[model samples]
Target: MNATGSVSGAERVLLRLADEAIKMGDDVVLVSPSGPILQHIHPEVRHRECKPIGLNGLRSPVSILKYGASLLRAAIVLLPLMRSSNVLVINNTLASPLAFLFQKRLLWLLHDVLGNDLRGAIGKTASRFFRLVIPVSYAAANPLPTGTAVRVVLNGTPLRESKENFAREGTTSVIGCLAALTPWKGQKTLIKAVAELAGVDFRLEFAGSAFPGDEEYARELRVMAKESPVGEKIHFLGNVDPYMTLQSWDLMVLPSVAPEAMPLSLLEALSMGVPCIATNIGGSLEILRDINGDLVPPSQPHALAERIRELLNDEHRRMVLGEAGRDLVSTKYSLEERTKELYWVVAASTDMAGKVPPRR
Candidate 1:
């Protein structure tokens, strides 16, 4: 169950898992906020929309009251489903408390590092009630209670065949940053770095929309980009299909200042043989293990720009990195392998007995 309605990395991962479960002859039901985003899910999977909830991230008293009300409402809606299902897999920690009602039947999937104080406290309290806590990465698991029943399940992506080497007729190298346009995502840092390389023949493509309360921040990014020396070179592509468009880019950049759990974008890019330049923080360092890509210090435009320039000038190095990235993803982070691991955990947690099917 995902708390938010938006089609972000967590939502995509949940959908992929549900699809994999369906393929294995398991009945899959998705309970999320009702929206057009639901259209992306497989038709075989059952879809249910939870009642619209107010912003739970807000620290205001009204927000807290609304969050409580939303949880109560969610519990009421889910109680009936909980009775019929052998296990409940919750995708977000905000909904973890609902597991308290189901106890052993519930599995909480942690997709991010518990950064918020209040949320972390609540997640810690809720962890004791859950049968298991499956964090998507080691970074995600580090903040959880030491003694909790935790398993680190690294997220995966479909392995794309390496593309044929193509000569770029265009002069400018395309650098794509495929993430939400938020402050901590470091889009501003990237823009600053591009501004530093005023005469460089490279275009920066920002390909994501803002979060709910981050519209102003998106506007700020636009203003920042506009004020940059190479303002026209910065293009905000809003939201594009990364799988379809990522292959067109020469390089992928993830400049997040905050700790990412395990960014699906990074995985997807690597799977498509796209070399990455990311900030050396959170799961990124873990993702870029063994020099799969370049790692720059977070919030440093000069460092980021230097790496970007270094990559842009060296075609052979970029090709080698891209091939290595694809190899790394195919070997260590395939969707089928990770899904099998997830299925095993689910099977072990429940009383499936002989009904638990073998991995396909």
Candidate 2:
């Protein structure tokens, strides 16, 4: 795990997976390049901390070599750790760089939809060791080679305990985008969209922390929000409780420019009967389309803004959409079922099936 402070959907899923594994009587050791993530580790799980590969370094010619050495050091530290493992579950292609040291005993729980660029090429190349590649969504699987070992395992969100009331009276309807503040997550696009909503009586909340080394972009977002005409209505709520957070909003938005494997925020929001509008891309498209939820074109703040206005005005439609989403969540995305399926897959795929029993 290339772990960090900002607990986005991926981090939440990782922690949840670990908790589930341990609950099922498996000994789970979370090994990672140390960061604020270590602070949030469960007491039940053994966290083996290692030095971070300085991928967060300043741009320089020698920086590459320095980081390369750092990566090597981290890999070496983790090699012995992996050798003892029965089934090594790696989230995304994060551990791919370390694959050369111990290639065989790895199960890639793939999450990224890398493009046809150099990074993507490298990610694909590393798939030579992916004895089992389980993508959280079909969109994530689409980018990989046709014959590559790919299994589509859509992320399952636990149902919200509290019922939502979309008809709550409010002079200022709150529009929120709950995701890690990053370039690809499209917080910028959301800000731009909200900026255009000057006539709309709405409060926009950007509820997430920036990535470890990406504070500059977070600063940029604050500046952008400050400069907008409705700047006072826009608030930056850093790392609030996602489940509790979704309950307060009249509408939720995920305006990601790039493809996510599957964002848990969307799932959580929808599960709670909150009306959501996400960009028509990757897993978001598949999810929203299935529930007949609203979606706008990626990077088109104008379209997003328009959709936001339309949804906020139509209370009945918003209620219906919310209900539909919640229904889908209840019927299909049960967390216990998904976790069991994951264990079954892991057990069935590897020779260490006996070691990785479906339950402890």
Candidate 3:
């Protein structure tokens, strides 16, 4: 997995895949640009830190050249790791070419959409370079879609809650922003919506952390929260255990202002039987179907606030929508079924070699 490989959604997906693969008696090798996130890896999984490749530490032209050298270094180092693996699960599109080099079976599990803003994450120049190169690399990599483009794995959720009935009380409802505390994610927009509904009996919870080098943005979000009218009503629970966190909320909001490939948080919220109110953009719309919840236009705090009000006032509607969300996830995003389908896709296209198929 070449993702940032932290405790984020992508990491969660990778960890689950690695853990299950281990139980099924498959030897898993996790490769990252930096050293392995040893703390997060499954005990059975092997870790290798490939040289930092692609756009890391490459802002200036000189650094870009250095990073290119690093890419070559990574490719050289990863060759052996690639040769030993039968199935290669790639998280980011940028690293697809590296996996392609060794003829490794590719399961391009995408968590974010690739586009201008995503490219801009590294910087304008890096973004432009990626836009130029990634598409061709992705095309050549030839990855098969895994049943659903997005999968949500719900861990640490109480199975008993699945059978229990919870009371639907007041406008004192919860709107959860299940994303990293970054500007691009639009947690500020969710806070603004909460501010708009200040006098209304509703609360918003900001649940997630900033990425490795984004502490500054996280601080800004803290400031924004304090200034908002519903500041006290909005709680910043920085990166809680997702399954447990979703249990306490009635609603989930992604509100990503940037383009996204897929937002797994939507899937997590759905699986936990919580209704969502996401922006009408990217993978948000793809997951938050009309039957499950509302999808308002991006950056419009008013629209978000109004929708929250509607859902808060109507308990029956919320229950119906939440139940529908759970059902949709159960049928479409079940990990076992999706992973099995993905296994076939990898097995069919790549050389499985001496590895035996895991028992169903």
> How much lDDT does each candidate structure score?
0.82, 0.77, 0.62
Q: Candidate 3: lDDT over CA atoms? A: 0.62
Displacement of residue 44 (Cα, Å) in model 1 is 2.1
Give the runs in model 1 whose Cα sits over 4 Å from its true position: 53-56, 163-168, 356-360
Candidate 2 residue-wise lDDT, 64-136, digit = tens? 6776676687777677777776767767453465555667667777778867765567568777667777888
Q: What TM-score does candidate 2 get on C-alpha atoms?
A: 0.92
Better of 1 and 3 by TM-score: 1
Q: Per-residue error at 6 for model 1, in Å?
A: 1.8
Clashing pairs in 3: 112-261, 113-260, 113-261, 208-239
TM-scores, in order shown? 0.94, 0.92, 0.79
Top lDDT model? 1
Q: Which segments of model 2 are wrong by more than 4 Å?
A: 2-6, 54-60, 162-169, 355-360
Once model 3 is optimally superposed onto the true structure by TM-score, how far is the C-alpha of residue 247 displaced, in angstroms? Answer: 2.1
lDDT of 3 by residue, 1-360 (tens): 664545665666667667766766678888775543668887777887765455333357886676557557767766676667665666554454543344323455555555444333332222222112211112221222322222232222112243115555564667788888777798877778777786677678888888766788889888888887668887888757787777768777888887554567777777767778888766666666546468888888889888888888877877787788777767666766655544444444456534556576
What ranking emerges by lDDT with the best candidate at the front? 1, 2, 3
User: Candidate 3, which segments miss by more than 4 Å at Cα?
Assistant: 33-36, 51-63, 97-107, 116-160, 163-171, 290-292, 353-360
lDDT string, candidate 1, 76-179, tens digits: 87788887887778787678778677776788878877876787777888887888888889988888876689988889888986543544557678999999
